[model samples]
Target chain A: MTTTTRGRSDITRLLLTQRIPLLAVLIVVVVVTFFINDAGGYLTASYDFDYMSGSLISAVPLAMLGLAELIVILSGRGGIDLSVGAIVSLSGMIFGFAYGQWGWPLWFAIIATVLFGGLCGAVNGVLVSYIGFPALIATLATFYAFKSIAIVINNQQPISTPPIQELYSLSKSVELPVIGASVPDVPLGIFTFLLPTVVAVWLLLARTAYGRRLYAIGTNDVAARWSGLPVRDTRFKAYVYAGLISGLVAVVTVAQFASARPDAGVSGSGMALPAITIAVLGGVAITGGIGRVAGVVLATLLIVWLNAGILLAFVGNEGSQYQLLALGTVLVFAALLNGLTTRRYGGTV
Target chain B: MTTESLNKNDKTEKNEKSPKRVRVLPAPVTGQEVVLVGVIALLWAGLALSTPAFLTAGSIQPLLVATAPIALIGVGMTIVIITGGIDVSVGGAIMVCSVLTAKTLVGSGVNLGVAVLLSVLTGGVLGLVNGVLIAYGRVHAIIITFGTANLFMFLGLQIFGSGTVNGIPGTLAFFGRGPDGRTLGVPHAFLITVLVTAAAWWYLRHTAGGRHFFAIGGDAQAARLAGVRVQRRVLLAYTTTGLLVGLASCFVIAQGTSTLDQTVGSGKELAVIAAVVIGGTSIMGGRGSVLGTLLGALLVQSVASGVTQLGWRSQLSDLFVGIFIIVAVGADLLRARARRSR
Candidate 1:
């Protein structure tokens, strides 16, 4: 295939692959909505619709987290970020305290939170890149320390988000269309599916010099460093970027849950794996380099869909306990798919 | 390339250099592995003596119990790492196996033999899935195994019906139960661990398949060039580790009730990885030993009991484990550098 065709084909392949996953999730949602409402118009139930909208909204913050780790993995540092969960809890606690008890403005709360996330991520980066600690071990240390720090500050209680009550009341509100009145489709709640940021990340990863640098560094760190790439700086940036994105996740998280739990993302300790699986399934190399943002988005959708579908279909419990099974299956299957792809291509992780 | 061919080429190309006198025989200790292992042992002995309880059997049972699963898991882990792959899903495999035995035997009418066999099967299947992903699916072993860990734990929960299952059939309890009445008066877990370690040592040190793991870990492409069946060895390593973990799970559930919590293996996988690394196994994937892993596990688990028996709270063990892991892993790194330099 010609170069352009290959690029086009890669895009097409990612779309096709992710289409199946997304479709699976969509089908599950549709099926659940249609059938589970055994009660007449249960689909129109206030709580149910609120939950549906709320879930997708909640998913975006996690996707940001998924994206944050995705960028780091794209740099090929072993798809690991042990401090992510802690960072979220820590930074979100800061945001919550500032906005609620401390009375910081909402936008200021976001700015401060994102910066704190970046700072924490930078700390992770320095430890991994400069200090020569293995990504897993260094982050492992930070994981405990960060959470402990947050616990010390928050005293192990969930904190309310300021200005969050507005979003909460809005999320709880059911929009009813009177005979001929049109309601502006659910006033875009704060951080609900921020389209611009996703596009920015996509372009940054796909079309820029820094993006290319990330791919190069990820693909072959030794070669890149030998070739005069700012190895340490690039790495530092990757972790910082992951942290900033995690901060965005923290922000949306506050809005979504309207409460900040210090324990948020404890179960997310192993989350980087699924994120890596999605990135790799979307065609990013685990060793780094040679991937695209489009693929990751697709893979993320696939994972979310498959998981949501499994629950909606009642193939498993529509609860957290069974989510692990669903995620595990997706990851392993994707991994197997990765093996097959590389085997055919004469490559290996 | 054949050694003979390379030797012939080297003679012709380096003929201008000093004549090649009869080569001096290298001492075993001169090898990097021996030197690194020796240094680590020295440091460990020094540390162990500081904690009065670290070396005693009574104080060491907690270590044995904690180390059993990790050591068993590490046995499989060493093979995989030697094959230049890793399986981070032992936690899942162990968790799943622990509960599978419990769920199947407790009030389920299954015989002990069958329940035990099923647990082994559960681990094998989990391993097989991981193996298939690593060997055939072509994903990173670390990642696929990560997912497997999650799936296994989730499956364990689903199959287990949530809360811990208790009152295991008595027959199966021999392996899982304490060594309170054993002839040797040692923790059965410790004995099983030794047996497993010995088996691994024999395999890795004596058997060609074992050598193949090192060959692959050293340089997989070179191993391929040397005509080793890389994929098959990888698969064998994974499956074997899974089997041992199955055994480990039996011991875990045996400790009290056949029932185990889903979190039973939580944080344990990293501990196993740390032990393997501490035991001089390269996380970068080339060298380590069954013996080193045993020592590593002992060192790790002992710290737990040593702290508590010596009167410190048990939570401090995590910090110690982390510190020891850093030191051990760091020592290996320096040793690797020194060896390479020499």
Candidate 2:
């Protein structure tokens, strides 16, 4: 009996210290709770697999931007990019002007928007890595600058020309080719945009020399410098990568809205805040040098499903307000858990 | 020979003591503060030259009233940042306080003192919540505040019920931009801000408790070792910020139309932070001045006013603000480098 109790305690410790397991458990709890509620006729609509799959559309931009934050925050030295939302707003407008009004080829417009986003990120990189500004200050300044430019560039108007409107098909639900009869149809952007980006990011982080350099520098900048790594260059590239991701998210956002609103990325509480929240909730250390792409993806799923359930449980705007409460409560709870885990178990995995 | 040696030793001791005592206090005005004053003056002069109405009483009074809220909140923010913590929830706190206050005023038509007291108390309670979590929980200030910001916003929205609190009485007219809000030639709101800033400046400079904040920010462990009551000091910092946010919300409501909307304090956090940062309050903590924050708020508002007067898009002002932050922080970094080299 004593051995069994000790063994069970050990398993508990593992679940608490390893972020992936903890998040997985929470996701299960959220889904099961909503399912129970739905069965009891508490939900306004069915909390079925189809609804869950449909909700993944929101996860596209959220997960992408969370990954963007993951990259920047992993660069250490108080690294963060508060301007990703601004980049999305600005880059989406560029996409609007190019594809919607200027009548450029879709592929070319996409490339230009991504490049423009990279250029904006490069500005943050130069200020932070080269000129020695704090990542917070550099990005805060850029957040202002990019947001201003996005708003004023087009006289505060959205671009929803015919081509842009036609782009809405990108977000439509599509059945899987081989398993079409068994599973719910997922949003097309999952395959066309989110999946590709996630795979690319995962490959880059897991397989490349640059990825090792980034983690090393983030872990300890002085040690990395002593080891002859290109510390500044690696850090700079992180911001650039984040910008690139934001640019893609902008395209996803524009397509989802079927219009390039100047405030698409920044309306209400703003995209950057939610992205950062997801990153942190995914067990990304705010102090840097610790996080995973898988963690961010799972975090996105958890929030999206949780929010979907919340929407079903309440009426009208009250649902959204309750969503904020849930988000805040969960974040605070997770953060406190992180602190406790660190003290009791020597930090999360 | 023994007498001459003893006299020389006493002279050296006196010289060392005087300089060390002087070093304990920073310069009355730092280099950054001087530069900020100069920049504000130059901008004012330029605006006056470009637009005849820029320096007029009508433009200036409203500008001062607008600056008051940001500057007042910035005073608390300056202290918080000085202690190596930040309170981003002030915007949300402002929303909750203003909405609640506005509701009370609209519902029962309370007197000015009662309304002000209610708002400040509400803010204090919010601040206390932040302080308890941060002080005892041992979490990052930004993370905790970010969470609370969301919670407070939710609370604020719930208070708004049907979207807006319309037909609010002008109970806060004393803090408004109208003639009733002025005492002689100075706006009452601006005067109150100046008075508060002065008091905070004195407290921070002359009191040991104030000096303790800098000690905590510089190194919390070291401060605790030296008997600084680190947790208590940290709690005080955030609570003070809450009270100030409460006061600033009143100023905000006073300056706005009678209707209280959900957007009451949406982005005010960033605006106050910009003012604090521009004022030479280091984001890294341990060094800052409330007086500089006041001036920073003044400068940002002036730029906005100037932009409008020049017929440029109002949004263009944010771009200038971003540039100003870079330039100010860049200059500070350069100064630090020079000092290190020296």
Candidate 3:
């Protein structure tokens, strides 16, 4: 009897403190509901494993940028990067110039683009961490600056050269070689870009001393300074790292689109908001100092699959419109839940 | 009468002897406001010289009309930011208000007053949603507003139904840039914005309730201990922003053509924020003025007009805006540092 009661409490604790488990349950519910709708012939398209797997392509950029925001926000002090979308737009332009306009090798061009994104992020970092600009103002300034440069740099044209067009193969669905028969094929970008980023970010945050320092500063910088941590440098590097990730996302975005569009990142609602939404929904505290890679990854999966289903549920432009509604509702729900969990349990999943 | 004479004598003696102890409100026209005025003057002179048509009524009137919505919203934003919170959903709120009011205008041909009231009420409801969530739920204002921005945008798109709300009536032409929008070469929209801004400036500066917002922003727990209703004040700030947003939407609808599209208020939140920050309002809260916000909006619109008139790429104005933000905020930071050291 005691074991059963203890087990029940353990389950409750897991559901509350661990965002991963809760996200997993939500993902299951979403998938099951979509399946029910599919069975009832209510969907415009089939809601199956193949369609779900195909949709993970969008998660590549979402999760990568989510990680970028996660690191910056983890450094605390009203930390946020409003310029990620702008960085992507600017860096993709540079990538376009290097790979499309110039006759540069693909690997070198990729490195240059990623480094350019890091430079953009570094600018934001120096302004925010060293020069004492507020993060919102600093990033907002750069968001405008980069967005303008991206448009002006190329005279506002997309580069769809031969080599850039070939990059589309990177985002195409690929069948797994060894375990390929039963399961569906997944987008190659998931393996080449997304997995590598997820692993690298996970190892960095989970294993590195810098990550610990970042969290310490985020939780309370004055205390961290008193304890002799290099608070400013740590926070500065977090922005740089976020930029570096944005640089990588630029490459993924370019490959996915099969062309480097000048407004790839800042065209509509912009990529930063969705990335921030993902990070928050993954249970990262907007006030800072608490988040995890697994949580962000799972949250990305949940949103991607849920969006995929929503699209299937509705038709044409209506599908896209409802996607906005779903994203908003889920984000608001998660935020309120974060508040409730923090108040009631003294911690959040 | 003798006690009053005695109190006046005491005040005069205190003012004379303990000058440092005597409280003095800051000057109405601050250094930043003066600098902004000078900069705007320089830009206008330069533009007038470089572009022959810049000083014309055709050129200047539209600029004033365009500046109205942003400056009007900046008044409310100045109050919100002064209270140590932000509302990023204004753009989305604008979309909802404009679309609803546009549809109403297209469908019913509602009179000008009723249309204005409808938009403001819509904005108030949206603002109340944000106020309650932030004040009571205790979520960060940016996150809650961002979520609501999407939701509001969704609501707006749903209202649009098809693609755009076409054939909107011109009942709000008084707020537009045409002859109907002006009297004695002053656009009515700009006139309204100026009057509202002046009123807000007085309310924020001279009133006890206005002082309460600054106290709450400086330190909420301390303000609460000091008998301020911190939550209610915060709620009011957002709601007030909403009411202003509603008014601004009517201006937006009037300024546009007969059709309203989905992109009506895109990136406007950032524009309004840039104006607020440039106006020397502290984003960290507890320090700001609506007067500075008006100057900031004017400077921003001036830059946009200058860039276009110079035949430079229209998008390049954003680069200038970005630079101005850095310079403006950087100057504020330096001044703050000097003050702290002193």
Candidate 4:
């Protein structure tokens, strides 16, 4: 090949193999494009550092769920959890009852809610890992069941007692104790919920034997089984972890909304779609066994920033509609890119 | 040339002959189908005995009409799933189709044939988008459909603009529950669904082309080696589903009042999927029937109607739906396990 061809192939190879660099470049491009649009005096709201930092609030739940999905998809065997959003809604309701109605201590209520979420996930794990049900079918059934119970449990009325209403303070933006004045305040949930989950998941995946076993089973369960690995248990734990994270997210959503809405998780296309989209865009192979924590976090940042920019780019309800268009377009683009890369270079991010 | 060698040759030939005979198409009514029919019948009988008004035409007519759209879409979904693909975008596609058809009727006073044709063609176009991306792009069916579902919803909302499509003319009254919609006490929508389902049943069971879908789903590479044209068949399945979705959108419009809202098809995809899975169709693909899909849709609709008539909370009906799905698939799973053990 000529020198030019060699250089061009080198660039293509880097773009296909190293997903983080590609996502970073895309983020920069998006920011620059929005800045240009803002400079042209076309934005409804200012597109600046302050606005972008404030929009990081959405990223907390998104990144948390994205990490949750990363764990399950990493387990392989067509593994997935469609009921994450439903779990969020159901657990949120339980949290509402404990903290708001029953007036339990916040710490106790939080722990109970998380455990309830894990219990729900265990149901899915048992069905999928032990009972031999397809992950998609098992989660889907639970999605429906949980959603219905969430609604009927409270007769579709959202719980917004005095304690729950006070909990809204948890979602407000807060300044860091040091060097915080130099930057915009970040959503408090980022500190309280998202960061802990991210660090825990990263450590669990990176520095643990369980994580190694998960990757082993996801890569090839039969091979792992032949090697005497606890394949089913590992897979089951992945789902339980996903549900546990979703449960934590339930508290975050309740805090944000100041009430526990029964349909909070399942409204519209639901949280599962966006979370899965983030995982895929973060270079998690839909076929399973390959993904990263940093990649998911970066992908969430890119989307949250892009969406915030789009919200500024348009006025009124049009912005939200266009957000759908943007999300759909980006997802399709990423999915197709995943396919192309897998064929061209024999792998994806 | 001894007796033992001759006996071995005879046994080998017998084994080969038996496989060829057994690989012949499965029976028209499977164990799952019989069980589904029995369950539905028992539910209906119980409802009729407890509630004197359950068997009346006023109640039954609406139930059949409600079932028509789901069963119609379920037929196409049956084919798609058999080919190892799914179309979650059907809900969004229905919204686009119905909203467009309703708007056209209200805006231009179009006749029935033109309206139906317009809806179907639009649905075909949308389905074609999903088919091309999934088939040619080589991505998974679920992801592509999920993406398209959002895109189609955006498109539908853009068309819907301000709000509901109010004051739609009854151009589709022929498919409604009114006297004009029926011939011999059968609503036109349900009748049409039945005829189309029957045709699909025959095509899937008896045709070489239809059997290719099963072959492809069983193993795509093997089917390719067998000259199945897997991609084209998969694309055709989605496109066919789109066409059916278009027609079902019309049924949805007819069943409603003079106005159509933006939430027209919000969760219809799940309902159709529930119906298809309940019909004993394997999600892993390669085994299904349109006849069973029809029966499944009927059973689900009956449950919904029964729950309401029994003065239960309307939302509680979904609980039953969830339970039914578990039971239906669980029974099939047990049967497969039993077969494996045997």
List each candidate's DockQ score.
0.35, 0.73, 0.74, 0.63
**DockQ result, candidate 2:** 0.73
**Using Cα atoms with residue i matched to residue i, what is each candidate's TM-score against the true structure?**
0.79, 0.97, 0.96, 0.96
lDDT of 1: 0.67
Q: Return whichever of 1 and 2 wins on lDDT.
A: 2
**Chain B TM (all candidates):** 0.83, 0.94, 0.94, 0.94
Tens digit per residue, CA lDDT, model 4, A57-166: 89988999999999999999888888899999999999999999999999999999999999999998998899888787788788888988999999899999999999
RMSD of 4: 4.1
Give the winner by TM-score: 1 or 2.
Answer: 2
Stretches of candidate 4 off by over 4 Å are A2-5, B1-23
Candidate 2 per-residue lDDT over residues A84-173, each given as its tens digit: 999999999999999999999999999999998999999999999999998888898899999999999999999999999999999999
How far is A180's C-alpha from truth in model 2 (Å)?
1.2
Among all candidates shown, the one with the greatest DockQ: 3
Per-candidate Cα lDDT values, in order, are: 0.67, 0.91, 0.91, 0.90
CAPRI grade, predicted model 3 = medium
Tell me the deviation in Å of residue B256 in model 1.
3.6
Tens digit per residue, CA lDDT, model 4, B1-342: 112222344566678855543335677888888999999989999999989899999999999999999999999999999887778899999999999999999999999999999999999999999999999999988888888988999999899997789999999999998988999999999999999999999898777788878877777787787677989999999999999999999999999999999889998898899899889888888888888899889998999999899998777787788888888888889999998999
* lDDT score, candidate 4, position B74: 97
In terms of docking quality, model 4 is medium
> Ten residues in a row with the worst lDDT in model 2 chain A?
A261-270
As for candidate 1, its clashing pairs are A339-B137, A339-B138, A340-B137, B176-B254
lDDT of 2 at A179: 95
Off by over 4 Å in 1: A1-52, A77-79, A92-112, A131-200, A251-260, A268-270, A315-322, A341-349, B1-58, B108-116, B169-173, B176-183, B306-320, B338-342
Better of 1 and 4 by TM-score: 4
Best by TM-score: 2
